[model samples]
Target: MSEIISLAAANQHLQYIDPGTGNSSGISEMLAPSACLNAAEKKLAFLYLDNSVSSIAAFWNFFNSNHACALLSSSMKQEFKDSLETLYQPHFIYDIKRESVDGYTMEKINSSLEIFISRISSGYSVHDELKILLSTSGTTGSPKFVKLSEKNLVSNTKSILEYLPVQSSDVTPLNLPIHYSYGLSVFITNSVKGGKIICTTKDILQREFWSDFEKYQCTSLAGVPYVYETLFRTGFTKKKFISLKYMTQAGGKLNEKLVDVFSQFAEDHNVRFFIMYGQTEATARMSFLAPEYLQQKKMSIGKAIAGGRFEVDPVLHELLYFGENVFGGYAESWKDLNSYRQELPLHTGDMATVDAAGFYFITGRIKRIVKLFGNRINLDEIEKVLNEQFHDSSFICTGLEDQVLLVGVKNFQDDEKIISHFLHSKFSIHPSVIRIKQVEHIPLTDNQKVNYTKFMEQHGD
Candidate 1:
């Protein structure tokens, strides 16, 4: 067996605090190398790692023991789990439900554990031929398993740390899942640096969330666009986060209004709001909008990180990323990493343009652009325009056979007034406007992406 180090040894003097409660778990005595070795002897592979920082640290220690490790999000649906079973055929499964660890069925538990232990003892390297499968968010189609190496995870984490700069004194309140590349990166980077990680199961947008932040004295927070949207709705004023030194937003584009609100909030609170851009393919972060230039280049995704470069292909209007942190390739069957150069200088599939200041701003997905009246119109650009005009309204623009349809889900006190305003707005290209009931909840994929395919299937072609 490979030499294993305990989390206590690695994170000496660090205390693991649960933000929801006042309880604290000290690492100096809790995590022992003997416990890790015992767990390893039991053959724990394919553990469903939870979203907490402590669980992530435990998993990392296991991985360091040279066991084949595959991370799965606790939030994955039954269908995704079923698909993963068919592909990887994991020997053991770890379920991270809420803030605790749960075991699997007896038959599954025994057989998988034996198989994983036997294989590891026979000199098989989990980081070598053994697979570490990651599922894509399934925004466009069925989620596929992307195979990665131990080097990929370690290298990517190192690369991100090089640019972001986390110190041991920092405490990151993780709001994202550990199964997710974004969430996983947060856990790994912080733990490796001996930083304090406070685990919380409470929703970050709730009124009680601020109290938890105050209780824990959280210095950093990371979230997706939806999380920030909830904060905006729940009256997230600048005064609440006096202890927060830095914040990050990712998973999707931050609407211009939210960007302005967050920027102003950061200015008042003396906190840095980093607007980052990334996908599952790149293991999480690929680019980050600099906090210093948040006001000057509000919508920009900023530049690439240390080991990555972002370029705009003018001919195709596709943003491409080239970096060592990029995945080897996607796997359809979770058998092995596919040998393909197709993703090199990885085509991000999003349309964007770089300004003279070198800030990159995404316009829309290439597939989302509509050819209207012989002119190309980006749906995202139109949505941005309409959203700015009507703050309380939600809209989606889709292209039909020859005409464009704009569906507005509005919360306007006077719907007619807002519709009339859009009818005369210069941004509107004389397209059809269809007003519908305000959407209480936007359908999202397991990865929190807008489920457009489901939307079209439910609504219309």
Candidate 2:
């Protein structure tokens, strides 16, 4: 006999508490039934899931019920919004405010519950051909919608959970935005294991993060490389995160020196620092470097997850993934799912190599490498070398036709000193340093990826 799975059975404690205000709501309370009404209802669901686990639960619940929903980030721009409205023609918009939601304008639809009940009573399967639409990082081109299905999510979540074990007692701080893949996985994984998820809408880079950690006794914290850089700059001492058990870094490769510093800091405070790797195309995580092997394999993205296997091409050196969790091919439009194929393994555009011990270390993106003077130069390598020289500063290395441009965001005097130090350092090749305008901050994508394409477009020749 087939097993029956209900939301209450799956998640025993279905109440998701907002850490910011201590407001608690049942899983059903946060959801609007009317949001899932048919095409003729003229009603749409606009979900703003910021620091609220209920928002995530509601989204999944509605999505699994065959309702159409759009993921909106707190930092979405007007251009992106205009494009989405024109394309989806969504009636309702889930406005996620970076700040407080006080005085925000949204239509108060009253028949949401009635619409939801009517749909559920009709015996509709929410998971049937579900569509999850997301915008790309807009690094290479305009951000486009990535449509995924219920199978895609369930497969990815199951595979990831097999690798990273999350117990029921584990409390994960919902730090990253749910609109992004990384943040969404945190919710999916934790919810599957019946663990407690603490919701905090405030940016973890801000001052309010430490207090929330203390209040919630959060066990795990996950972020991108830049987030860790911010914590280091904000003078976040080791004593501040006494309750933290494990911290994972992903979204982008972190500096090796910064990794060493974080490993030490976590050691002092009795926490495990995990170096993880993933992209939206493969769900959130593909592999994670264990805390114990971090020192020896400091730069490795570790081995593949339990059910997944990774191989590097002998000729091209590109990393390839083979697993069920791999997404069902890309879709240009929502109706194109019929033409999507599940054949062939996923080819990640990253160049990587496996060590003698079987640990996979990503060298860099295949396109990010520059051929200057007949010698191939990896921008990531130059960035790593520069990071080793300057501990606290942020640097982005981009390739020009004949030279590699190193952009440093630091104090004027310190920038010069760091540049001088890098020039003297022994790398296989040395590029000319062009000191551009010193800025207070580096621009990052919605997923916390360094906006390299944007940087080149705005600053490069």
Candidate 3:
């Protein structure tokens, strides 16, 4: 490291704020790892935390080192979690205090994480190339994980910093959880630049969240397409703010209608709105629609990030990404991570087409999985669940370009209600976006397999 860079890094700080109870903490980036992370068992560990400061502090100390971390979400299904326990057996686990919701007691919420971790007996061995393990949005209840190395993280983070012009003076409230790649990317990109991250567990809906935002002088906010929906509904535009320098939208595509709204809003306020696109496999981001061409390009995933390249497959038209940030591969458990291959120009599994202006537009999913607000859910996985639960019922699941999933269930009692409840309880998907339709029968091809195209054509709303 440069002497100047080292001197400035020494002055950098990390602040975490709790909007609910109004508690806060400050931790240094250079703090030593906990005693739990000794040489003997420092190979792999699981990291789960909300946007809490203590957790973030612990994360920097433990996760941002030689000991690779398997980032797991609390919202993930138990089946997937169990599979991870069997697969890449996390040598040790580090999770913070789970945020208390309206119904759960404080004690219940806090103890929940510990109770769950205690259930795991032993973990499998992690691979050498596995510097970081990230779950692929719980798609299909399959133990699909994007295995990233230190090179992937560093390369991608540097690219993000290069474009965003991140600075040590900048402050961002850690509104997004660390488990999500998008959220963790913000933490890594900001931290590397010696910037401040104000960790918080407060919901964006709460007034206290904004209050803390103002108090901490938060310079930027990041969210998925769904968050923009609520942001407008909450009258976020009416609020006055002097500090917010930029806003980034990723996780999934934000439709043109909202894009127009955000584009104009950001311009009027003199704040940049970056429409970005990426996959967890690329270590976080591969492309971002530059703020200048946001209106002209309109809904394009834009061009590749610095040092990254993407090409469309001639036959499948699936997007394939090439970059140092592209992951080694996926890991279902410790054994899978045992030997990692360098995957360059990784086939992204998303169908797409390139614009004349060099922008990329994702058209459809060739992979049975669809990402909902950045979480990947396999249509087949949903079908498998329904089959296990209902013998007399037949089900086919499909998703729209915008990620709103559709389930066509035939011969099921209270089909909508039953399926909606099951999806919510099992997958943590809300019924609001899930459209349940009563179908006479699932469309099938000559081979007797469910014809997804025909099913969508016949019953898609």
Candidate 4:
């Protein structure tokens, strides 16, 4: 067992608080009822979790047990959820949202949570070292899962803690979904401090979220680029949260202008603002820019996390990371779970360059390039250009071998001509190859990332 999980399970000072009901329960007490699961042999369990105490308690219950668990979102579509259930054939299905599965008998753990036990054996052997399975596709419900072991989780947790200042007296809110890698790391890292964790489904846009945050005196916050954008538009910089000591951003890159704005805000308010870089394959974080360097290196991802090293491929210029936290491997089916692949020297698909001081900056994704008229055009660069130009709109840029498909969301459909003129003026690309479409809302993956794959599928024909 990992030391972090063991510490959390045994710590009586660690409490999971439900802000909705103002109820609090110690970790030992919350995890006590599910001790029967630990008696079982090595098996596979599917955990559909949310941001509530019952769901988190159920997760810790299975995590501490010998069984390997797959973390999934509770709000996943029924068909997609059923597809995964059919594909994996897990022996146990612990669901917080659904009532039952077709081939499984439901057993209630609490009023809001239940475990479905399979009627027949799955006849599949799960590797002993596999601790957790996280989906690579955010909300797309892809069959692929990144396998993580106890070592990956613990190493990554310790690396993040080496830079983050989490105290036992601090209060952290579970605003992000635990099914996502970033959210899971936040939960595990804070658990080590044995502090009060506020479990709620409320987001920053909700009035209830602020009420609970102020009520509990929450000390820190974390979000992705979109969350920060919403915060900036909603006047977050003007308001003062007396208890906020630090903020962290990851999941995807934030615009350089926004980074500067937040950096200045953090300076003015005496709060630490961290710009982090990570992926699900690394078990959460790979690098973090120290708050002190935000002003000087606003575009850099800073140095690698503790116990990790970063290098760029000389030939391909792709970012490469070597760390104990690299995932075991990817599993797409039941048979894939039988063997654990300890693949190392993770190859991040993004092209990056490291400076003399060792700070890393991602130029673009290697796969996000389109060739048109004998010129290689970066799709990510195009999207960034359009997004920065049109402050009120978001754009998704995708393309084939020689054509570019640009999809705009929010009041920019007729700006196609303007976009074409700009691209022609900027990149010297012909206007005939560029096509634009308008949509009310851009599709997002389960983790709230821009669904570029879906966009390409919809518009790249």
Candidate 5:
């Protein structure tokens, strides 16, 4: 039997409000389509979802049923989405944008959504423990996915709730997408134990988003580093939201200066600020710097989560994590789903150091090193230096070749020659090998991380 989440009890107190349409509904309403997905046969379903009532209902139905599903963004490109469908050949597909599938019959779930039921099976069996498949490459639509089990989800959720201060009366806006790991955790943690959830597609930059945030009196805000950066640049910290009790940051390392700025703001306002660290491989979170120690240990990733532990490889200095939430390996094709392979003691690929208090600091990425002119360079370090120097701009560094490095900058007003000159003067990097590309905004994957893959493609690399 599947370890399905029974909403019978949670439904009584769970209230879902969609600010877009001014609609308020109970969790029980999400169960209306449960029968369509609860068929006795075990199958795989593809759920392309957005933050909306219908999408939530479909996702809950598939999750509660015995079926295994892959959660994808509804905004995925049609060709990329079609490619995955052809590769996995899922038995069912729920997409807000799709009208029909080649060998499937369509059922209209709502005005904005439809369900596609395949006419024939793909002749593949899904592992009993496989419950969710999250894309490894985010919006790039790579076939690689991290496989997660029900135990992984439950364990991570419990661990997060242990440290995150959320209450039954709190209200939170779904500021992030549901497909991203951090975003999914925000939704699940709030749904299972927190309080009322406001479902909206509006992002932080939109005026309508702030309007809804104020109208609903959102109690908590969750964001990645990019989101936080945008908030700080937009004078968000200067303003006050009385309903906001706390804030959560993850997805990437926020600059130390900005971390201190936000920590001080949170302190003055009596709001808790949690700096967390994790990857999709570990479900969502592996560690979090507690609000109490934010000022003293602003650079630390803090201690391990409630049930997770971290270790640094003696030789490589790479960060390692051990926990129930560690994913059951990865899936690149449908055939790989035949069984679950637990690749434990996850090497996080990040080089880190731990202090006497057991607090961890991420130094750099092991894979981010590149050879340029017989000198090894760390791309992450270059980015950190440039970002700190050019506080008004954002920089992403990538080595394209043995002697060539590309620096992608956004919101930069200075001459490109200045960047090259600075690199040559400071790092002894020759100007001939330094390439600079400026953009109005740095391209971000659907999950809101720097889209290095897309950025590289822009240069035809």
Candidate 6:
């Protein structure tokens, strides 16, 4: 691979913190050192392998100026990778270091960015109209992607900035992964206002993380249900973030009890806690429970953003959204990447009900997929993983909206605690969201099919 530029030489658009030292220079508007793709402003698309601070810096280097890019998790399985390679045929793949990359042309842009190009042309067109490609519900294995345009990204970013005003003086930690849309939006919105970001991979459970959080006087933090639960268990009340002004939550429904607790905490500390609702297709967020309505509409996902509004389907109970942020649609293969106009007022697969005050509440998902800690866990995919791990034992997987997973296993010898822990560490499922139950047997109907309804009814705990 030819070396294009070293990180030390790249432009510095924003001053980032040292992950180990927690030190950062003030925000700088100077163009961050970035490489110009050979095909500047061309209707080209490339693969982005996961979140690396530097790679993202390189991405912003050209996101709007150069070419459209598709973001993917680096840890995707091979079979899925092969299928995707056949679909969009990303002109280049960005990663940290070089390895076997399906024999694509490799080039080193800098310490944080590596690019691999395809040798043979694939008969697919990444339409000039397409901008960003995001995975649907964080499913790396799924071939389908959400197609977003420049208008979608900028409009959503502006709406969020309007509600959660930021400043150049503010210092926010990069608390979420860059590959995740929620986390990525934080980076984009903060950048739009020229706010400083304390980028680190530190976990909340770590003492060093807290020390760094305080050292920089970080202004805000973001998390999912699992993160807040960890904070509660680890004594979030006693700990003090003197400079912290606000926090945000999404990805999954928060328990009603925790909502009351966090709302009170915000009041006592004079901080803001934003409860939000969104999907990948919405380009990140569609609605949020404003701090003012936290107590009155405790569970409502507040009214739509500035230029958007939503309606509930009386019969299907699906949330229908009319907004500029709605994505172009789904793309499963290269053939599906053509320029297709998106009609306003889209159907969100989430089943919901609206309150008298015009606020929306998500009651359940229209499908069986469960959103846990911002990750999508398919019951069938999870069951397949469990079956491979728990040999000589059988289990059942059932999923629903706004609830934890219920895993039922028969003839199990492992302790329940161990089972939940394994699911958390191995499958990335939060321990609090997974419950292992000892069942008599896998529930079945007279037709010899797995009776998911009867099984959940009997074993759900």
Which predicted model would earn the best TM-score?
A: 3
How does model 6 score by TM-score?
0.81
Residues 1-461 of candidate 4: C-alpha lDDT, one tens digit per residue: 55667767665557889998899887666554545676446788999888899888888878867888999888777777888988999989988667667889987665545689899988888998898999865554667799999989999998999999887888999887888899999999888773899999988999999999999999899887767888898999989989998999987778788898899889998899999998889999999999999978878988999999999999999999999999988999888898777776898778899988889998877677554532346577778878898867788777753345454555774546888887766555668888877877787899999888787777667
Residue 237, candidate 6: how far off, in angstroms?
2.2
**Residue-by-residue lDDT tens digits, candidate 6, 117-157:** 66765545566667788876553466667888777877888
Compared with the true structure, what per-residue lDDT tens digits does model 5 show for residues 33-78? 5565666666789999898877887887778777789999888777
TM-score per prediction, in order, is 0.68, 0.69, 0.86, 0.81, 0.80, 0.81
Using TM-score as the yardstick, the better of models 2 and 3 is 3
What tens-digit string does per-residue lDDT give for candidate 1 at 1-461?
22123432466536566765556655433434434334443232555555454565455444654445566655555455556655645445555442321223322222112112222232222334332455554211133555655555666677767767577777777677666677777876776664677776556756565677777778888777767877788777635766678888887777789899989988888888889987766767789887999988888999988778988887988999987666767665534432422257877778899999788998777566443432334556666766777777666555443244545454656645455355334433453433343455555799987776665555544
For every model in order, what is the number of clashing pairs?
A: 3, 6, 8, 2, 0, 7
Q: Rate the local accuracy (lDDT) of all candidates.
A: 0.61, 0.61, 0.73, 0.82, 0.82, 0.72
Best by lDDT: 4
Report clash pairs, candidate 2.
33-116, 34-112, 64-126, 64-127, 65-126, 66-126
lDDT (tens digit, per residue) of candidate 2 on 1-461: 00112432366654466776776555545545533433433223445455565455556454534454556664545454545444444443455442222223333333222111212222122223435655434211122445555566677777767756467777777888777777778777776674667777777666676777777777888877767777787776445665677788887778777898898888788787888887666766788898889888888999887777899989999998876656655543334333334544677778899999999998766666553322334567666766676667777767654244546454445537447455434332433544344556666799999887777766676
In model 2, the runs with Cα more than 4 Å from the true position are 1-9, 28-49, 96-130, 138-141, 331-339, 367-461
Candidate 5 similarity to native, TM-score: 0.80
- Whose lDDT is higher: candidate 1's or candidate 5's? 5
TM-score of 1: 0.68
lDDT of 3 by residue, 72-147 (tens): 6655555655566556556555544343222222221122122123333344445555677787874334577788
Residue 353 CA error for candidate 5 (Å)?
Answer: 1.2
